[model samples]
Target: MADTLTSILKKLLNQPTAPFHEYHVRAQIEQYLLDVPNVELSTDAFGNLLATYRKGKHKSTPVWALGAHMDHPAWVKVPGKTDEWEFLGGVPKNLVEKKENIALRKESGDMAPWGFPVVFEDGKVHAAACDDVVGCAIIVAVFKELSRLGLDATVHAAFTRAEEVGFLGAWHLGKHWPFGKDAVFLSLETSRPVNGAEMGDGPIVRVGDRLSVFDHELINVLMRTAAEQGIRVQRCLLDAGACEATALQACGIRSVGLSVPLGNYHNLDDDQNIVSEHVHIEDVKQMINLIVALVATKHDGLGERTLEERVNLRMKEYKKYLEIGNAKYEEMTA
Candidate 1:
């Protein structure tokens, strides 16, 4: 058989990177896509890497800007001993103290872990960085596939930075996102499992998170695409953590979040021990498939109205009946 996604996922997990310091991970992605002739790579002020892929012949209407943050929760070196550093991001301190085998990325790029593998595989590949690196890997894979297939469509994939702390990279990119105003921004993420979203249930078209709701039309577009393609998918309001979509939407961009349900989110197990985070390997694979399907879907296929808008229109259609007493229900008859 071809190479298992497990192996590819492990490679992505082992790429040591920290917030505001995503050079190594970004370089790895660049190397992966170096030979993709249709792709042009560039960097922004906040150190976000933007990969733009040009369509060859059958370009789809309305280009899509795919986003995935490059950084996850990691430790940053302090002024003390070179090995000593402050654990940054939202993984929780109680578990930080419980963390045993850990690793440090040295100045020259060598990593020394404290006895634990970057990933511990039982069934799924479990590691610390799956949160958004999975997002990065998925985007790069989609970009390459689009190029290799010669699918005529423009895709702007951005590997953003410092998302765990705050949406610093997205906020900066939002101010002057190079893809014109109409370009749809769809963010990919690995979110804590909950809210009807489970690891093996396929990718989720996020309705919203804790802070704000996503674009209804965009969510509809993804769901409609999955349906037409017969791709397994779930829709949920993933409120466990906010994603980059919210930050970009704040800038008046039409943004939405697509996530894979993650186990042991942020590496905090049920007992609060620092352990491996995982998503169903199939979830990762299906997410990539969904990305390609969504991009290929035509604007007309997505429909012109949001689900909420369509439902409200139906309610309005019968408003006259309620006013005039149709007598269809006991309340109306009374």
Candidate 2:
């Protein structure tokens, strides 16, 4: 599985220009999904790959969707010579500068590296494609784990395309598909700095995003589950960026974003900014645990609690701590 993860990352990095060209990254994932049992796969008009693993003895149980965007920003080729393709400027400077054996396919569709140092060991180069590819890998990993454990509700995985280009894939899916109006939606994206989800820190329970706030009942369930399971998790909100969950929320679907802490996100000026070695297997394990809990609760029905309700519950807990501090102050005065 570790080697498979590496291979998926390498494959994505190799196709930096058009990450969603169907035959490129999509073909690779399609092949991988074939190995798992009880999986039904299909694609939408907008190229959103949907994989469903039905759980429960009956098919009428509520369905849950786990979304992850598979597309990354890349330089698209304009009409020109194969070797003379213009740098259309979507890649981060750090990736372009540090990329080994950097290649380009011009409007003619011919491929050739720009002739720098082509870094190919068994064959792989470091690049920015890992941004959401890591997310895709996590979704696949969770699916495999859930299948092994035998889940109870139908768990649907949607690998949407064109997330970098204004969340086009998610918009289409949420608008057209029947994703269950009340289904629990979780988007696996990259987390923020400092308070972000670290690679070894376990799965992040995102409280809110740039677009919309998560369902409070779902957040509380995840938080309580993590605490009880002794899993490391961080609560965070991205200030400058957005995820597929944002688009879903805009369409009135309850969603939350989960991310593994990433180092170099969109900033391309410095190679050091890129995540060096933070990706850890332990974090992935905890993520699997959270997914399992959610899948197991298919029959429990979506909780009636609201975001305000959960916030008040937290405030009550905080008040106790405040009272302790007040008592300490009074004793000191006496």
Candidate 3:
């Protein structure tokens, strides 16, 4: 499993990608999934890639729809100009202006854009596009592992584009609504660590982002699964930036988020150098492990509890205390 994780990460992270220019990343993902059994791939009208994996019987009523973007911050060539260019996506402005050395694509390619080279050493990964490419890689690994184990489950994954520029791909998909409304969406991200989320601790069960709160039931399910499987995971609100989950949730879909804590987010370090983004290798592995377990056990058969149900349970527990308090108040009043 670790080998597979490493292989996918290398392939995806090495691809040249930018907002609205995710051709190479999309192509790599296609090549990787070509022979995976029981999986079907398709693209939405807006050019987002979707993969569906269905096998055996499903234990949960709502199917799982996982999503990740395929773009990173890069300088895009301005149309009708040879030398002029404009930056897309979120990176520190000071670092962008510095114009550090970027790793160009191996062969002659479209627009000839470049980014930071992927370097994996000392149990850490530093890459140009770990922001969401790692997220994309995680989805690929999950699909492959689930097929190999032949788990009875249904999972859909979306490799969306242009996330770095305000969730463009995600917003479009939400408008079209490809997956059923009943399906729950999970946004996988390599996010800036905030609110005590730390790299190497484990993957984070994101409670919410800056934009919106996620489905409580889904968060509970993810946390429960991690505890049950003994996988270390953090729970927090990664408000460093908004993710694709916020867009889906805005469209009225039940959405939640998961992340691997990132360092030097968007290729900008504390000193403002334009270097590769960083993530702990073990955190990536644990993210994969937790997602696989969630699918394999069909969310550990913990049926989604309604708000009323949760409140009722608590209410029942405190009812005797409420009665006792009422009697004491009545005696006082009399």
Candidate 4:
């Protein structure tokens, strides 16, 4: 595992956080970023942590965002039972029944990655909130490296909330989006293996999912970056469920998704036991490096090529044939 990633994940994977109750996780993020120059941190009205880098860029340069949901499937609240809270999000009943060693969020105290513990073994990282904490942790890692390198890119990150239920936090930010309308947003994820997606095969440049198709331009840039830099990648449409990118796109932000294939998605094991969700450590590391590649590469005229420039130029190659053939065919027409 990358040292920076390991350090961040170990500290974050154990926190009793739920939608609208993400103070602990937010605190950890803020503390880690306090000394990071050229960055500003703030929360939206909905408590979505926003990290915007102040790096310089030109009009042609890309001003984009990388994001992940802050909340995962969790106990709703545990007031009366004193320690037992009702389940929230999309864990099915059969899986809930399979849980034998379910720990109380109260007992977790500090280490509470929704409900499971962080485990490292055989080049894999297993934890309850690996779904998007992996995404969130990578966001921190990307921002740190980009700031250090001072890439000529304007990048920002939004750690959203309540995506497991619906993209509520994403919606709230969209209403008052600080990133300009033209900014491309990429939703980082840890998705289940599907549509040829697999663990340890490197991260995916998700084209779309159950909700809607993503922006083609952003997807192309990501794919080209990975290929040019030799970062292993897969292209897939993970339709199992909708992600935050879906909500943001619905709100009119140019958005797409990227992910590392996960095991035990949402912590629902094959036999329905509540267990740790896992992902390849190398996949995580590569995804971070790929993002740096995205920021470092210039896209000066990427989207500027007009339809005429592409199609009309090809038409010219055959223009003389049309001219010469027309005169010869006119006699036949008569």
Write down the TM-score of every candidate.
0.84, 0.71, 0.90, 0.88
Residue-wise C-alpha lDDT for candidate 2, range 1-334, written one tens digit per residue: 4335455555544543343433455776787777777788898888888888776664322346888777655444445644443332245555555554134222214322222121333323334455566677667766766677666457788888877768888988878765565465778876544444444556677777666778776676667656656677887766546788888877777777677665445423244332322244455456767766666654333544556778999989899898999999999999
Please report the candidate that would top lDDT against the real structure. 3
lDDT of 1 by residue, 1-334 (tens): 1223555566777777777767778888887777787899999988899988876554455568999998877767764567666666886666564535243223333222122245545556676678888898888778766766777777788899988788999999899888886687898999986776777889999999888999986787788778877889999999978998999999888999899889888767788666667877778788888888777656674545766788999999989988667656766667
Model 3 lDDT per residue over 1-334, tens place: 3337888999889888888889989999998887888899999999999998888667454577999999887877777777666678776555566534333322224343345577889999888779889999999999889888888778888999989889999998888878776688999999998999888899999999988889988898888889888999999999889999999989888899999999888877787666678899999889988888887675533655657888999999999999999999999999
Compare the candidates by TM-score and give the number of the best one: 3
At residue 18, candidate 2 shows an lDDT of 43
Better of 2 and 4 by lDDT: 4
Worst 10-residue lDDT window for candidate 1 reads 107-116
Better of 1 and 4 by TM-score: 4
For candidate 4, what is the lDDT?
0.78
Q: By TM-score, how accurate is candidate 2?
A: 0.71
Clashing pairs in 1: 101-114
> Residue 58 lDDT in model 4?
37
Better TM-score candidate (3, 4): 3
Q: List the residue pairs that clash in candidate 2.
A: 94-268, 101-118
Ranked candidates (TM-score, high to low): 3, 4, 1, 2
Model 2 weakest 10-residue run by lDDT = 111-120
